[model samples]
Target: MTLDPQTLLAILAMAVATAATRIGGLVLFGFLTLDRRQKRAMEAIPPAVLMAVVAPTALATGPAETIAAAITALAALRLPLLAATALGVAAVAALRAMGL
Candidate 1:
């Protein structure tokens, strides 16, 4: 499928906008100094963002998803983050395959 000129321009605009935001954030932060509280808050941001993204899906979904989420949480407590995520995905795939 061919993209029209307007579509191409729009895509280029989006790419430019994304790059600008990313670079701007880094540049803005580079010259800043954070206090202890601010540093801690910055560290907390990632997990908070992750929970915000995952909580709704895990809470609203069916038994398979619930079970997978439980597995993910348990594994996360003991295992590395990537391993926990993989385990969660595997559990969900297995459960769905078994028609849970």
Candidate 2:
């Protein structure tokens, strides 16, 4: 499939925007010093963000997704975030394949 000039430009713009945001965040954070409370808050941010993004879909979707999310949460307790996410995805795929 061929991308038109406008589509190419839009893709480039998005790439630039994404890179700028990442670099901007790094630069902004590099100069800041975090205390104990701030560090704790930062530590909490990842799970909170994950929940914010996942909760609605998990709640609204079918049992497969919900069960997958539960497994992900349990795995999160013992595994790294990426591994837990992978587990959730795998669970959902397996459940769906079984016609759940």
Candidate 3:
């Protein structure tokens, strides 16, 4: 199937907008200075963003996902973020396999 000119242009515009947003964040952060409070807040952003993206679907889906999310959140307190996230995924898979 072929995209019409307007559709193609819209897609291109969206791509550019996404790129600009990401690049602009990097560029802005590069020259910015942060005090302790600001730095702490900045450090919190990743997990918050991750939860924002993950929570709705995780909670909305089933008990397995909800339990997995909770396990992951607790793990995050002691484990690295990546490890915690992986644990969450594994937990969900295991729970599903066990027919939870």
Candidate 4:
């Protein structure tokens, strides 16, 4: 029911700092060229970050989710992103439906 001025100011400052750093990275990348390995590493970043964020929660939930996450990871090795994601979703749904 109340908003604190100091907390709001801190939040605004953090937002500005985050925006500045993101824009700065874009500007810096614009002036730089990455070689083959660097390019590949950069391209893999999004998925790596995604897994890092999701792995803990997925594994911690229960056996059903852990199995599905493993299935998804293995599927990702050979299948396209969309297909792998769909398979993972289906696996979890089926497992949960069976009272996992």
Q: Model 1 residue 82 lDDT? A: 76
Tens digits of per-residue lDDT, candidate 4, 3-99, equal: 9999999999999999999999999999998999999778666556656777999999998898888888888767766787899899999999998
Q: How much does candidate 2 score in TM-score?
A: 0.75
Please give, for residues 1-100, the per-residue lDDT of candidate 1 as tens digits: 8889999999999999999998998999899999999997776565456556776898788778889888877776667667877998999899989888
Global lDDT of each model? 0.82, 0.87, 0.90, 0.86
Sorting all predicted structures by TM-score, with the top scorer first, yields 3, 2, 4, 1
TM-score-superior candidate, 1 or 3: 3
- Which pairs of residues clash in candidate 1, taking residues 3 or more apart in a chain or in different chains? none
In model 2, where do residues sit more than 4 Å from their true spots? none
Residues 1-100 of candidate 3 have per-residue lDDT tens digits of: 8779999999999999999999999999999999999997887777777888899999999999999988988887777789989999999999999998
lDDT of 2: 0.87
Q: Please report, as a residue range, the 10-residue window in candidate 1 with the lowest summed lDDT.
A: 43-52
The segments of candidate 1 whose C-alpha lies over 4 angstroms from its true place after superposition are 54-61, 70-84
TM-score of each: 0.63, 0.75, 0.81, 0.70
